[model samples]
Target: MRTLQVELGERSYPIYIGAGILDSIGELCAKHGISKKSPHLIVTDDKVGPHYLDSVVSRLKSEGYHVLTHVVPSGESSKSLDVYEQVMTTAIQAKLDRSSAVFALGGGVVGDLAGFVAATYMRGITFVQIPTTILAHDSSVGGKVAVNHPLAKNMIGAFHQPVMVLYDVDTLKSLPAREVSSGLAEMVKHGLILDKDFAYWCCENGHKLLALDAETLIHGLERGCAIKADVVSKDEREGGLRAILNLGHTIGHAIEAVGGYGRFLHGEAIAIGMAGSAMLAERLGRDESLYGETIRMLKAVNLPVQLPQDVSIDQIMDAMQHDKKFTEGQMVFIVPEAIGSVSIVKDVPVEAVRSVVEQLKGEG
Candidate 1:
């Protein structure tokens, strides 16, 4: 097992990554100071419940911990206020208290929903993340929890860090082909924003990663998580240095909102958004090669680099207008300055963004 730390001083936490670590969750909980005397809630989804929920529940119960389970239907739609309220209702009836902790037992959706519950329940409680999807390697680490507002993705959210993050690589083996591609998009983003060699390394190892080779997959996930941990540790509140993490999120979140949170997965939307950011950089006359390089890296892992023709540019623009990143009538963008660096440009013109979106649609 490999352990990484999110050093926030008093609020710091540890991230444990390994194969078959789910069995040790109960012991880990006790080690992390989670009290067995309190009733705990485990929030998961229909898809994940059948596979690992029983084992998780059994493990916690064996350790003398009182457990409650709330399973929601899987997908982006579950991250809604309606569903959030339903889970809260369960928590209230179960009488979960401040000493209790919430365990997120599925993918990003479960993590976000459960974490939001933990954050707001009784004005905040402890939460743990057990991410089953590779795409969650990003979402599970950072404390950015939220339910969609229909108008924008993650519009209603908070920065509540987890007490610990338990990642069992075994969970990733069950992912479908498209999901694997979607997850790697964030791994690629990590490289693009911070590590040049790792960016190209991802491209070179695309086939191995897609095949789910144990060594390569774990290495990639560890690197991705480490990069995220390093960033969140320095700028816990996204005051300054942390905005770099939004490299593709500005356009990506808009795509999810315009799609009604159903068409593309989060990472897929971010893939196209990253491509658009590179193109935006080119439009600003930084470096023409950046676009081609970004596209190559995305294609290496089989991610979409262009917007679908059916998605209206006007609708995308309207969605961006509602994005939290949009302020004072100007679109904020994290434009790529190079393969491994980005600039948070706050005064981006609306027409330039439209031109880039149009150009993306024109790509074959």
Candidate 2:
């Protein structure tokens, strides 16, 4: 097992990544000071519940922790106010208290929803993340939790860090091909924004990652998590330096909103957004090669570098207008200055953004 720390002083936490570590969850919770006397809630989804819910419940119960499980239908749609209320109802009915902790037992959706519940329940409670999807490597670490508003992705959210993140690589083995590709987009984003060599390494090892090679996958996940941990530790509230983490999120969130949160997975939308960011970089005369390099890296993992033909540019623009990143009357963008660096440029002209979106749609 490999352990990484998100050093936030009093609020710091550990991230444990390994194969079959789910078996040790109960013991880990005990070690972390979670109360066995209090009722705990485990929020998952229909897809993850059948595979791991029973085992997780059994483990916690064996440790004398009163466990409650609530499974919602899987997908982006589950991250909604409606589901949040339903889970809150479950928690209320279960009589969860401040001493209780919420365990997120699925992918990013479960983590986001469960974390949001923990953040708002009784004004805040402890939460743990057990990420089962590759895309979750990004969402599970940062305390950024939210439910989507109709106008924008993650419009309703908070920065509530987890007590711990338990990642069992075994869970990733069951992911679908498209999901794998989607997850790689975030992994690649980590390198793209912070590590030049790592970015190139991702491209070179793309095939091994896609095949789920044990050593390569774990190493990549660790690096990705470490980068995120380092950033979150320094700028816990995204006051500065942390916005770099949103390298593709500006355009990406808009894509998800315009698509109604059902069309493209989060990472897929981010992939297109990153590609668009690179193009915007060139348009701003930063580096012409950035676009090609980013395209190569994204293509290495089979991520979409272009917007879908049917998605309307005007709709995407309207979605961006509602994005939290949109400041004043200008669009904020994370434009790549190089393969491994980005600049958070504000007040980007609307026409330039439209031009980039048009170009993205024109891509074959």
Candidate 3:
């Protein structure tokens, strides 16, 4: 197994990446000081349960671990206070203790919600992430976990790192085409903001990566995680350098919130958001050629480069106002100066944002 570690001092954790590593969950947990005797909770979603949850449970059980399962409805809606409380109640009812560890055995939603539970239960408990989708390659690693409030996505979250992240590439075999495309968007984002080489590699090999070809998927997953790990290592709480990771996320989150999360997969919204931000960058005269390149790369991967036809400018503005990146009621946007380059724009004028949205809407 290829392993990467998140160096967060006391909260440090390891991310294990390889094909068929789900079978090694028991040993992984054990290595991290988790035991069979300790109460273990497996949190998954309806969609993931039938596919992999049972196998995960059996793996841990074979190691003589006592395991319980809690499956939530799958989708962005699950990231709500109601489901968070439900999982917490289940953990409490099961008598999960400080020694206990929670196993998140699904995609981004499962990882985020379960990790949030682990962070809050009994003050804090250990959690392991078993990501089942490509999009999770980013979400599972960073310590950011939380549910969406009614007003905003990820408004209530904590910086609770996991004890271990077992990224079994095998699990992604069942991912829908949309999910694969969604994940590629993030990998694309990594290249845009940090590594130009990786970005070019993605443009060349996106199809192979999406096909779930074993070697290509593993390479992309490892490379993406490596970039994310480097960024998080320097700024765990997103106080500074880490904000670069939000290359498309600032406007992306607003789009998601306005469109009601499920309308566009996180990556789809990012695809459009990145395009819009690139346009904004062009208008601001940061680098016209890079903006054109951004559009080309996004379209190359089948990601939407235009805003949705149904979305209104007012809805987009309302969502941006509620974005977590807003400071002192000002919206901050990360725009690309060039491929493998980005700049943060704070207090972006409402008129500038409106003009871009109008132009995008008109084009669509």
Candidate 4:
């Protein structure tokens, strides 16, 4: 196993990444000081539970921790106020307290919802992440946690850090091809923002990833986590530089919400969003090959590079305005300057935004 640390002083924690790492989760958490005396809750979804829950529960129980689990239906809808409340009620009924720790044992949805539960439960309890998908490689590392709202994605959430993240690449083998492709979008985003070489690497190797090449995935995930961890360490609250992490998320979230959460997977939406962001930047007079390269690469993986033919511009515009990235009433967009390089843009021209979204819609 390889271990990397997110340096946040008092909130500092280590992330373990490797094949078959799930087997050592109990020993790992105990080493990190998660008390065995407190009740432990494993929050998972219906999809991930069958493959992972038993192994996790058995490990924790063997370590002398009283473990309980709350399984939510597997989908983005589970990250709602109603579900959050239901999980909260479960915690209360289980008699869990501040000392209790939450184990988010699935993908991004599970991590976001369960982390939020731990953050608000008795004013903050400990939580650990056992991410089961490639997408969670990004969401699992950053302390950003939240449930979605009708108006916007991840609107109701918090900056709750996990005590540790245990990523087992083996779980990915069981993921469907669609889920696998969806997850690669975030890794692509990570490369686009942090390293030019990494971005190109993802473009070259993404197809291999969908075929489940274990070595490529392990390498891709480690690099993705390192980039995210470095950024989160510097700006834990997204005060500045960390905004780069939202490279394609601003527009992506809008697309996801407008299409209805279940319509497009998070990464699918991101694939299109990143393509649009590149085109928007190009239209704004920032000439970069990233525009064409992003489009070409995303297409190679069968990821969408444009809005659906049926989506209306008005629907997307309405959703974008309500996006969390907006500041004081102005939109802040991340635009690519070159491969692996981006800058957050403000005062984006209305005409340029409309033109790009309209053009992308026409492409579909």
Candidate 5:
């Protein structure tokens, strides 16, 4: 197994990445200080329940852990306040305490919801991440966990890092094409904002990664996590250096909120959001050539580089206005200065954003 540590002092944890890592999860948990006798909750979704959850539960049971499983309805709906409340109630009824830990065993949605529970349960408890999707590779890290408010995406959340992240790349083989495509959006963003060479590498090797080649998938995931670990380590609360992590999120989150949470997967919306941000970058005098290059690479991965047909400019603009990146009513966008570089620009004119929205909509 390839082990990468997210060194956050007392909050520190190691992310184990490799094929078949899930098979050894019981031992992995024990090694990480999770006890067999501890009351544990494995939070997953319906979609992932049959495929991987049972195996995980079996392993934990064999290790003598008292494990209870809670499978939420699959998709963005699981991140609603109602579900969050229900899960918390379940944890409470199950007698979880400060020592009891939550095991988020699905993708981003499960991780966010369960992690939030771990953050608040009995004034905070331990949480382990057993991410089954590529997207979770990003969400499972950095400790930014949350559920969506009725009005916004990830509008309510907390910075609760996991005790450990067990990324079993083998679980990804059965992932649907759309899910894989969605996950790649964040991978693309990682390359764009932190490492240009990594960005280029993704463009070149994306196909192999998608095909589930072990080496490429592990390497790409490691590189992406390394970038995230470094960023979060520096700015745990997203105060300063962490803003770069928002490379495509301002526009992406806006698209997601306006389009409705389930309309597009987080990564799918982010793919389009990156397109919009790249276009805005050109208009804001970042780099004209990068605008085309960014779009081309996204398209190569079968990611949507354009807005949806039903979406309107006004809705997108409204969502962008409400974006968390906005400061004092001014919009802040992350635009590319070059292939491997990004800068946060508060100077992007609203009119520029409007134009990109219109243009992208036309493409759809």
Candidate 6:
């Protein structure tokens, strides 16, 4: 087992990454003053609930903790005001309080929903993240929790860090290939923003990494989470440095909103968004080699580098305007100068944005 710590002064937490950590969740919580008699809310989805929820409940129950399970439909659509309300209702029925804890037992959706529930319940209770999907490697770490608004993705959320992140690699064995690809997009994003060597490592190890090679997945995820944890420690609220993590999120979130929440997975949309951002960088006279390498790497991993065929420039631009990156009515972009380096460019011209969007329109 490899352990990484998110150093947040008084709010410091440890992320335990390895196999079978899920079974030891009860003892971990106990270390934090939570015992089996404490009320524990296990939030998951229909797809993931069947696979591992029982184990968590059984473990907690064996330790004598009161456990309540709330399983929602499995998908991005569940990240909405309606679904958030339903989970809130379930928590109320479970008698959750300031002393209670919420354990998110699924992927990003469950993590976001459960974290938000914990953040707001009784004005905020502690929450632990037990992520089932590799995609949660990004969402699980940063405490950036939120349900989606109709206008934008993650527009409605908070910066509530998890008390503990118990990532069991064994849970990823059942994930589909597409899910694996989606998760790696963030790994690629992490490499692009922080470590050039890691970005190259991803492309070099692409096949084995996506094939669910245990060592590759564990090492890649630990590195990605460590990068994010370092960033969050410095800028927990995205005051400055943290925004770099939104490398592809601006155009990427727009792509997701245009697709009506279920069209593409989060990482898939970000894959295209990263491609678009890199194209915009190229238009600004950034290195051509970096642009080509990024696209090549994405394609090598079977990720989308273009918008959906039916999606248009106008639709994407309209959605982009709603992104949180905009300041003083100008859209801010986190552009890559090369893998491992990025620039925050604001007041980007619409014509310049259109040029890249136009190039990718029919390419899909």
TM-score of each: 0.95, 0.95, 0.95, 0.95, 0.95, 0.95
Residue 245, candidate 3: C-alpha displacement in angstroms = 1.3
Q: How many backbone clashes does candidate 1 have?
A: 0
Local distance difference test values of all predictions, in order? 0.90, 0.91, 0.86, 0.86, 0.85, 0.86
Q: Candidate 3 — what's its lDDT?
A: 0.86
Off by over 4 Å in 6: 324-330, 362-364
- In candidate 4, what are the lDDT values of residues 1-364, reduced to their tens digit? 8888888899988889889999898789779888877788899999999998998999889988899999999988899999999999999998897788999999999999999999999989999999999999999987889998866668899999999999899998989888888998888888888787887888888778878787888888989999898998888888899989887777788788788777899899888889988998887788766689888767766688888789888888778877644555557788888778889898676556667788878742
List the candidate 1 regions with Cα displacement exceeding 4 Å. Answer: 324-330
As a whole number from 0 to 100, the lDDT of residue 112 in candidate 4 is: 97
Q: Tens digit of lDDT per residue, candidate 3, span 126-218?
A: 888999998899998779999988766788989888888999999999999888999989988988998888888888887788788888888
After superposing candidate 2 on the true structure, give the runs of residues whose Cα lies further than 4 Å from its correct spot.
Answer: 324-329
Angstrom error of the Cα, residue 297, model 2: value is 0.5
What's model 6's overall lDDT?
A: 0.86
Which runs in model 3 stand beyond 4 Å of their true positions? Answer: 324-330
Shift of residue 110 alpha carbon in model 3, Å: 0.8
Report the C-alpha lDDT of model 6 over 1-364, residue by residue, as the tens digit.
8899999988888999998888887788888787555577899999998889888899888877898989999998888989999989988988887788998999999999889988888888998999989889998988888998865567788878888899999999888999999999999889988899988898889998888888988999999999999999999987889989988888788888888777888899999888888888888889988778888778766799887568878998888776545555556788899878898887877677767777767542
For model 2, name the residue pairs that clash: none
Cα RMSD (Å) between model 3 and the true structure? 1.8
